[model samples]
Target: MEWHNWSGSVSAQPRTIARPRNESELRAAILATPRVRVRGAGHSFMPLCETDGTLIDMSDYDAPIEIAADRASAWVPAGWSLARLTETLWKEGVSLINQGDVNPQSLAGATATGTHGTGKDLGSLSTQVIAFELMLADGSLVVCDAEHHPDLFQAQRLSLGLFGVATRIRINVLPAYYLEERVEARPLGEMAERWQELAAATRHFEFFVFPYADTVIFKSLHPIAGEDEMPHSTDIDERPFRVACELGRKANFLIPPLQRLMMRLSSKPSRRVGPAWQIFPGERTIRFEEMEYELPRADGIPTLLEAIGYIRRKKLPVAFPFEFRLVAGDDIWMSPFNRGVGSSISFHQYARMPWRALFAEIEPVLRGANGRPHWAKRHTLGPDQVHALYPKTGDFLKVRAEVDPAGKFVNADLARLFGIERK
Candidate 1:
């Protein structure tokens, strides 16, 4: 909602949008509407938050966070954006153990959808969660964690916004540490050969491979020992070829063919270094829809290469680069990396192109390799398939039924997806 979802690909229409200032208001809204769903930053490419009944905007629920006296943890309002939360917590000398690239997402929204970043040593953001306060549809509040209401805690961590509205979350905090990032253009061959070692070497690791280009950008990050130390050796914009590539991307639609042309013409190695956030937040000005999957780390490289080969052979206009990342698994029920280390492959095509065909071409390859789709990203899998994938699906539904038996918090789509019918 803050940025109109920038993606602008949503198709859902809400009967009304409600902004609640507190738990009582949210409970009242839930009870009042026969059907409802919560909307976050609207970053989800799919219509998970879609509802004809009502939409709850938790944006107004932002409240100041409090750090624990031990400095080991802190609590934040569910609706707070990652950007504001990080900036606020930085002043208190603490930071999230890991953060996704873009920080514009709300806390509950990001966690609910299993949004993540890459790090073998570090896990996805939700894995750092210590506890949360959930406002149930029946106007009751429940606190959950690994010890208290363990089932609810696990399921709600990445509940796809189906369980209830989370009002606050408490997460383990790490001492704020500066990060030094290194980036280099490497051959795809190197990625295949050293993938395992590379994943193990850094605090965070990711790569980008442009279609029709022989080169791949390998990026790594590590914690810096001291403050005030510069993260990278040189300015990121020094590479004229990379700069040209970035500029040309802005006009990709008018010059879609130019991308392949540029890749062929300016084929050269490039490098850059900076802080973790700076390096991670690279410009993705090109417009495209993404489908990502998280798989066990051991199967990651093989699955990705096989998918890439399929794309190349099929000659899909997949002009946008592919993204590969690693993250430690969490207990979040619907998270792709829920139970183990995960390797993610995100592919995209220009927005104007027919997404249905492209996605159809790619889905089989991903599914063949045991990949689980990112809940917020584009994927056709509904509740039946979702239950088959997640181990705790049944338990989550049982609890959800008890908490919102009237289906007050469920949208029609969600009801069908979860196979829940109001009695």
Candidate 2:
């Protein structure tokens, strides 16, 4: 049998698959295999989950959420999907501090990859974690937190599953809140003209702009009194968009006109009020290979425009839109948004369209702007590039080595990126 990621861009044929039902079983499964790699929701676009030794699945490992006595945080099973975790937390009168637009990722997977939402003051999910319970390479369990194991905790915040296998995560939460979501179509020029005003207008703000199009789908979400109106239905047939992508795939030259037509038809005004969890994640069934970069906030607009200009000038048939937003920074050792307030730009292409070559052509534009790619997204950085972009790569590797000395979690791609020698 074969294991593949959401976009079918990465796959692995492991020697064995272990589905652990409990901690004892999980430990036994790990100790029984010479090498192990944990499995999450398989949402990563990169080869993070590719393994040849043994693949361990924890989706079946479920437990009740343990709220802190002060009600400031909760211990959640790392294997639970963000969709499940957020819904469950809402019922407990609490909510996650922030959430990404797509929510199928496991709690640990999101945190490890520095998954985030749009907010100038809100940091990524990794920053919300208070502690972690991990299973080491020797199958021994240990807990790490700011007070107990500072170095390990710092590294685990965004370790990309390198340091250890996270079994449970202590995450901060807030009193349940509601949000009013608004969407409108606007001219592309408006992005730069009112960048500061737009970012400050809402708690969550973002825009999606297809490379060949002149308009953008602007979206904003802010706290609301309650659900005063019906929420937007997520039940529209996506065939129209899919058909457009297919047309472009067959005849690349028709991309620009097709995109303009689609944008014109999609221009509409709509609003919805719903619980924060429900409003945070949008339905994302359309498959696309994505590459995301985090840059200094000042360089966002110019860099995005340059990249988009190149696509338009070259008549590139890129099929998906570029998502642009803001994310607060953190001190996490391996986080791309750790340096300072950052601007996040995500480049995507319809899964069926030609992508790698275009990504190769544009990755340099981002890198030249001092951008750092999301670990789980597409990027072709060698070890030196990785070390240069992340000054703490040595520190992260040090902790990774200390926890998993035998390199139990290192796979071929990871080995190449981290300069680790594989036996």
Candidate 3:
């Protein structure tokens, strides 16, 4: 059977697909195939999980989460989705420090791809990993952390599942808390001027701006002192928005007017108070192809303005809103936020519409601004571009070679990105 990602943008035909029930079975599968790639919740837009050899699905391995007695950390199964993990953590009186808006991604996939949430003080999900157990190509297991196998730890944090398959991960967590969420609409100009201030003041902040519209939907999440009493509302319904997107796709000329109308009709201020986990994730039911780039915090506004100008000038048939968020710096080798505070800008197009041309045209603008593509998002960077942007590219490649010298984990797309030659 053919495997496709959530957005249906990427597909793979693996020679074999294996769902290992335990570590021993997983090790056997790895040793049986010359090439292997792991598929999580199939949330990535890129072809990272595509392979012609063997595809390992970790969902069948449901290991119990082991929380530390001090409530400072937990040993979690890599196969668990963020939604499950966060729910479990909350039950144990703890929660993840930060997490992206969407919660369907598996823990290992999110960490390996450097997935992050919006905040000035919090780094990507990968940064929360205190230790992990990696199964190498040779089926040899090794435990790595900051104090032991330090280099491997740095590389594995955002390893792209290239170094090996992560079976279990120990993550630093915080005591369970409640959050107050506020969503409002504001003029784009106001947001541009106060982005920094807003990010600094809120525990989590992000905004969504539709093309051809002057308004932005601003959202802020802040921790509160009291426990939450209100039931969480998971707004997973996107039928109304999906209808708008379809109209935009079919009419093309209606994009601008439709976007403006939608903004006006749906821009009402809303509030929600709930547990941190409940408030952190947003329901994402609409399918779309996305391309996100992480730029220096200083260049976010200018780059976004340029992108908007380009879209309006070219009249690109895109209707999905552009997403903006902040992420703190980290030291992970392949993390886009490595050593620099970042502002992530995401461009999304309705799944049925044409996006390649639009993405091709705007990529140069982002690249010119020294933006680095998110590992799981769409981008056209080759090894040279990747190496130019990431100073530790060589180090990461060296470590990858040391662990999987035969390049057993590399597929065609990864080979091009990492400049790895398959044996």
Judge candidate 3 against the unseen true structure and give its global Cα lDDT, from 0 to 1.
Answer: 0.90
lDDT of candidate 2 over 214-321, digit per residue (tens): 899888889888949566455234778889989999999888999998888778787888888888888778899999999999999899999999887877789888
Candidate with best lDDT: 3
Per-residue error (Å), model 3, residue 128: 0.7
**Which regions in candidate 3 have their CA more than 4 angstroms from the true location?**
226-228
Q: For residue 21, what is the lDDT in candidate 1?
A: 92
* Tens-digit lDDT string for candidate 3 (1-423): 799999998999999999988879999989888989999989999999999889998877857789999989999999888998899889999999999998989999999999999998889999999999878999998999989998889999999999999889999999998889888899999999988888888899999999889999999999896554577887334777888999988899999998898788768898888988888998888888899999998998889999999999988888799999999998888889985898999999888889887789889999999999999999999999888888999999999899999999998999999888889
Task: Please estimate how well model 1 matches the true structure, expressed as its whole-model Cα lDDT.
Answer: 0.74
Residue runs of model 2 more than 4 Å from their true location after superposition:
235-237
Model 1, 29-86: lDDT tens digits are 8777677888887778877787777788887874568889999889888888787777
The alpha-carbon RMSD values of the candidates against the true structure, listed in the order shown, are: 3.8, 1.3, 1.2
